[model samples]
Target: MADLVIADVTVNKKASVYFDGKCISHGVTFPDGTKKSVGVILPASLTFNTGAPEIMEIVDGACKVRLKGTEEWVAYAAGSEFKVPGDSSFDIEVSETVHYVCHFG
Candidate 1:
């Protein structure tokens, strides 16, 4: 996919580190106060719990994900997206660096 350009957004300098630093993201806020993050995941497997419903858009590379309540892991590539319910968790396995934009709602 082409680069994601969200106009009039604020990008914070602080990095959101997770999985003992395996996953990292930065804070981004929209004009209306909605929150989001753009980050890159290293080659690793991680489980993430969401506080809000998240729409994860893959910006680069690929990964396999198994969402909550699901037994199968699906492959996602660049230009694809997945959703995770709030207060739930999911598993992601990445073989390469994967860039993503996460929209919180």
Candidate 2:
């Protein structure tokens, strides 16, 4: 499980909105220079490309994800997580409003 509270991190004031506002996120930087994004995806099917390896932590709601080169769609709910390889893409089908924290490396 991810931490409920992250202290002393820098938060970007502006949000990154995508898919015509169906997805929105705010970037955060930790003291150690680690980067992450806290975001929400509304009920929609969307494809996302990743620049860096990422672990998508589900904070609330549920989603089904199909990674690049994979045909299976795996279901994930709150308290679950899925990893995406760098430079890869994934298709996501959101059944509910998904609140997530994306850890990047």
**For each candidate, how many residue pairs have backbone atoms clashing (under 3 Å)?**
0, 0
List per-prediction Cα lDDT, in the order shown: 0.91, 0.96
Q: Kindly list the per-residue Cα lDDT of model 2 for residues 1-105, writing each as its tens digit.
A: 567766899999999999999999999999999999999999999999999999999999999999999999999999999999999999999999999999998
Candidate 1: stretches off by over 4 Å: 1-3
lDDT of 1 by residue, 1-105 (tens): 466676788999999998888889998898989888999999899899999999999999889999989999999999999999999999999987899999888
Model 1 worst lDDT window (10 residues): 1-10
lDDT value for model 2 = 0.96
Clashing pairs in 2: none
* Candidate 2 regions with alpha-carbon error over 4 angstroms: none
Error of model 1, residue 21, in angstroms: 2.0
Note the residue pairs that clash in candidate 1. none
